[model samples]
Target: MAVAWYRARLVESRPQTPTARTLVLRAPGWPGHLPGQHVDVRLTADDGYQAVRSYSLAAPTDGDRIELGVQSVPDGEVSPYLAEDLPAGAEVEVRGPLGNWFVWRPGGTDPVLLVAGGAGIVPLTAMVRARGEAGSPAPFHLLYSVRGPDSLWYRDHLAEDTPGLDVRIVYTRTAPPGTSRPPGRVTAADIPGVPAGRVYVCGPTDFVEAVDDLLIDLGRDPATIRTERFG
Candidate 1:
């Protein structure tokens, strides 16, 4: 598919978690996108040097605004700009809704297991929202691993009161005070006991690889696993 550039204006920007922010943009003529699609944003410096970065849309596919959840990476190029500098009404150029096979819609009959590490939850969150809104028949499960409770994105939205979803949180770095589990990384043991049909994993390269290995060991079919690796 051809990529088209949209001159989008920031409509709203707010923190979703301690380290991440959700940016909502309005592109007047922007063609709507799929749940797992991403957009490449370009920013120029004062000297005319430019940096480009890709961010997944966090909002459901049918929303009027496009939302992105960006985690602030220390000294990272585009993240710091979007987190600290970009503001409402700022004009930015972006291209896409790209990628073909990775997109996830809500209509499937098979169960879905979504595993996300750190800010990798962005795209999967969109899938969850879409499925919930559509009253999809597919059962959904989420395994979201973060550094600590403070860094867990969509904390409010993932509560048990939310319908049609099963969510589990794994705090790798710091667990709540008085918790028994050691404060560390997510291990194969942390995975919940759920029958896997289709699984989607997203996170840093090492994280995704580790989870993929664990899923394989747990008897999940390798062909049924889909992954997206970030730096």
Candidate 2:
């Protein structure tokens, strides 16, 4: 059976970085989604041409509201519109609350580790928010890698010293003044020494593969790791 596409109206939009935007949409009758799921957004042009793209859910639903984090892809058909041009009250067709394997549910007592690269942080951010919303006692550690400070997302919230959550940021190209780690790709040193009960890795294909290998080398059980990757 085909998943139904519902009309979603843009409620608000906020900038995460110069090229990334967070969109809040009000989709009436939207079934709530898991933290790591995504939705497909369909845009129709005046000439009857349509384009669709999938975006990670930035947070769990709030009643009829759902959120997505979009990083603009230069010269792309879909992302540029979502990241820069879409305006409030504009209606688009949305399909999902999709994917199950990547999801993180609330009841576990063990620590959770999250690894995100660039826009991959979108879904992981949702997991973090869900953890807080559910009041789950699971400790979470987030290791996020980006090109530089200018590209970071959820800056304000991540900067906070939230109890039971540890947030680490890695800059691949430029580092802020006095940052201990030099600007470079994430290395084994960036990964936690302690093993987490459940590990989630999301990022570019290369980044995810590198992190998975590093985790395996550090004696983390392959069975305990879950990964989601994108270009």
Candidate 3:
């Protein structure tokens, strides 16, 4: 649950979307992190002001280096620095590849359903990456929702054809030309075929709650679903 804060250097900062960046960080002795784990990043100002924020790990568990996806919040304190201002070699205070309740490990052939909205795709992507690294044939499905094409993260990566995985996208506000579906919220119809076991949902608090309700209405037992939410 707790780990010592250490200095992590930003080795690479890759843009996932217009508003989000994935910072690849390497620590001297990275203890490694499980899929869906997160780390706290701390920033200090020249005037001695400090801001701390938690960012989800965006990469697989196979490496000493990890990626943290940061979506800049409007008028926020930390993300702006992380997404834009922070240099590649900048040092950051980081703590824990934290959280246990939301993790996905490499085992079992049960189907995995991952529902994500906006930046919530971060941790779930980690799970997908972990599954790929382990070469598990488990069926993994991702149902992702966003306002428009611009809001979608990991655009190129998502378009890639990963084996044993299926991704469905729902556009809430706008879609490309010749789309029949209206811009609206995701319903049970947006997702088809419930996984045989536990389903994971991550997104804004409201999105998580609504999806949870919808899943239940679709006859999924509430106890078998796990959720991690961000504001």
Clashing pairs in 3: none
Clash totals for all candidate models: 0, 0, 0
Better of 2 and 3 by TM-score: 2
Candidate 2 per-residue C-alpha lDDT over 53-168 given as tens digits, one digit per residue, 9 for 90 to 100: 99999997688899999989988999999888898899999999789999999888789999999999999999999998888889999999999999999998798778899999
Please give, for residues 38-76, the per-residue lDDT of candidate 3 as tens digits. Answer: 999998889999889999999886456879999999898
Q: State which candidate has the highest TM-score.
A: 2
Give the alpha-carbon lDDT of every model: 0.84, 0.92, 0.89
Residues 64-145 of candidate 1 have per-residue lDDT tens digits of 4788888888989789889878977998888878765667876786888999998889989888888877889888889988
Give TM per candidate: 0.93, 0.97, 0.96
Model 1 pairs in collision: none
Model 2, stretches more than 4 Å misplaced?
none
After superposition, which runs of candidate 3 have C-alpha atoms over 4 Å from their true positions? none
Assess the local accuracy of residue 64 in candidate 3 as a C-alpha lDDT between 0 and 100.
62
- TM-score of structure candidate 1: 0.93
- Candidate 1 at residue 197, lDDT? 77
Model 2 TM-score on a 0 to 1 scale: 0.97
Candidate 2 differs from the real structure by a C-alpha RMSD in angstroms, to one decimal, of 1.0
